[model samples]
Target: MSADHAHALPAGVRPPTYHHFEDLAQQEESEKLGMWAFLITEVMFFGALFTAYTVYRNLYPEAFMDASSKLNWKLGAVNTLVLIVSSLTMALAIRAAQTGKYSQVIWQTVATMIFGATFLVVKYFEYMHKYHDGLMPGPTLFFTDVFGEHTPQARIFFSIYFAMTGLHAFHMVVGLGILTWVLIKARKRYFTPDRYLALENVGLYWHFVDLVWIFLFPMLYLLGAHYGLGH
Candidate 1:
């Protein structure tokens, strides 16, 4: 594509060539590799937190179970379902972008944002419940005698729970912002069947966020299910 022709294309649709990239395929591959590299860093970051939680749970299994029992598993499950649906919609949005169906892309992305917002709303309620119960995992923490002398150990569990889930929620907010930006360009009639590198990157991120929750829902909420505490 010539300079004038490339400039004439919709801004959100990537050009067929750039000064740095040999061709559209090379540009697309570079973009995907960059996103994957960033995602690997994210995985390492989350992995450290998971490792810490694992060590603590192994050392204080009873305390972990007791603390996990107090969490609202039902709310966690609801959030899990919300994310699953959001992932589906996000995938559909990418497919639409690939098919050059701009309208479908917009609606599907909107569905993704709505479901993501729903997950956060449910999380807000859960946080408020814990806050009201003095279980927010801070200097104000008061686990009650329900946890007995294991309260201290359980405090560790709450701290990690808040850290992991709070980070996950932050990611959702960021993903929503990206989707909004994409939606704006989409409204302006951007991207063609072969020019959706940004949208593809966003899809990878949205799916990663959902995958994290998939691990979190079971690790944090369902650990004590057999004992009837998490159920």
Candidate 2:
């Protein structure tokens, strides 16, 4: 048989295999499944931080409360609200993408990114305040004022607070990066009404981030705020 009849072999060119579904749909489903797996791991990752926090708080109630009192609940609460709004926007973005509303998806994604950035900015200010006040959790410095001279347990409280909040902030940064990629793809109109798994998975991730913050707010901020007193 001639070369043309022998599958038309070309240098460095490979024949494509026929898939049951089109490439785009297959890719979309695969991406969605991958995102769900990633979210599950994220849950486990944050779970460890929470467990550590619980252990420390249970061991040093007074020190924990003292440290918790120093946190600016007003700022934390505002951030919580910001993240909640972002979650809603992210979900809406997914819906927009599913309905082939490219403009809406792009705008909603931008809105979500803005809220994510706002959360980071607030967290930065909080960290700055803590650092300036010498509230770090260790013998390095600043524990005396934060926990009083006699209380050594304050270090533990600060340790857990830093661990939990810092981890959450890192995840927020990751989410922002993910959203940036999604925005680029959305701008290119890569997603269609029937194949928008990327948007949906990112929505799941956004909600998970929001959920983690919901738990963190109460655990790190409200757990020891005079609720356990006189019990």
Candidate 3:
């Protein structure tokens, strides 16, 4: 919708509908609130997965550590760095929106997309390596080899691994789509210093993505530390 349409709100009355809010500030606030609420639910959603992962890891410490060792920590670490930088740039993009720096906002969002793409590229390689090794979610080659014959329980660990990481990666793709749209809108100056609800909402979503990785890193990569795997 165009700014002209935005100003067509009833006098002194902004609809509680944030996307249609006449007052830009009110819209931004509503967007932020809605984003936070959505993020809270996301946290809970991933939290359940994390809890299940933890329980399984505890159940088979050796198998879990062995599985963890199979992961490419170097790639994981680099992707973590990329995402952290992307989060910083995303936050800066929001600040740029607040200041009405349309070009800066567009570029920052573009930079974030690049970093996000890099992360996905790395993830692609990681997934490819695992798949080629037959380490997918199933009772097939993923087990019986990677986790050692003694560690049958590790198959369950890898199952959760694929499910959790796969879902997280899917969210990254969604965020990338949102950022791309925001970039186009920013380039067209759809967001004024007063009316950048889209930017604010996307920022909130991006931050939530980062937060999920914060938990995933420790849970997936660092969970088996200090455990005696007998490897």
Candidate 4:
């Protein structure tokens, strides 16, 4: 197609071609590769924390298990389901964008945002409970009293818990902002079936965040549940 014709195409119907790309497909491929590379960096970022947790957990298995029991698994499980549902909605939004269903895209994006907000609300309560119980990462009174013989080790477990979950929560907050932006753009019909690269990339990010929680829930909350390590 001529440059003028490509430029005149309705929003979302045709992908935009970048200066370096010979065609829209090439541009899209380049964008996808860039996003994947960024996600790889994100993986390494979280992987480091996972490594630290593994080393510490091994060093103090009993203390770690004991600290794990203090967390509210029921709430963690609920949040897991919420995030999973949000991921589903995000996927649906991307599909809608791909199909040129702008209305569906808006609704699905809004739904995903709602689910994400709900997850954060639940997380707020969980954190508040921890604060009230004096479970803030240091050698606090609750930590000392609850894990008298294992205070030092248990403190390490709580530290990891807060660090991991806090980082995850921060990502959720970022996802919320992304979804909100997507919602606004969808309302303006910014995405079209052939050119919803933004939606696709954001969906990939939301999915990655959700996937992280999947591993986190099992590791931080359910690992030793059968051994009475869950509250």
| Candidate 3 TM-score to native | 0.83
lDDT of 2 by residue, 1-231 (tens): 122222322233222324754775566566778888988899999888888887878887777787777788878889999999999899889877666677788999999999999999999999988887777654554436535652567777777788888888998999999999999988876555655665687789889989999999988777555664321
The sequence of per-residue lDDT tens digits that candidate 1 reaches over residues 46-73 is 9999999999999999999888988999
lDDT, candidate 4, 186-213, per-residue tens: 8887877667888899999999999899
> Candidate 2: TM-score?
0.82
| Every candidate's lDDT | 0.87, 0.78, 0.78, 0.85
Task: Give the CA lDDT, 0 to 100, for residue 2 in model 4.
Answer: 27
Candidate 3 lDDT, 1-231, residue by residue in tens: 234434543344322455567766666576678878888899899989989987887778777777876677778878899999999999999888667676788899999999999999999999998788777776554445655563567677778888998999999999999988998887776766556666778887888888888778767776555553221
- Off-target runs (Cα >4 Å) in candidate 1 are 1-14, 142-145, 229-231
Q: Give me the displacement of residue 174 in model 3, in angstroms.
A: 0.4
Once fitted onto the true fold, the runs of candidate 4 whose alpha carbons sit more than 4 angstroms away are: 1-13, 138-143
User: Quick one: best lDDT, which candidate?
Assistant: 1
Q: How displaced is residue 194 in candidate 1, in Å?
A: 2.1
Clash counts for all predictions: 0, 0, 0, 2
Each model's Cα RMSD: 4.2, 9.1, 5.6, 4.1
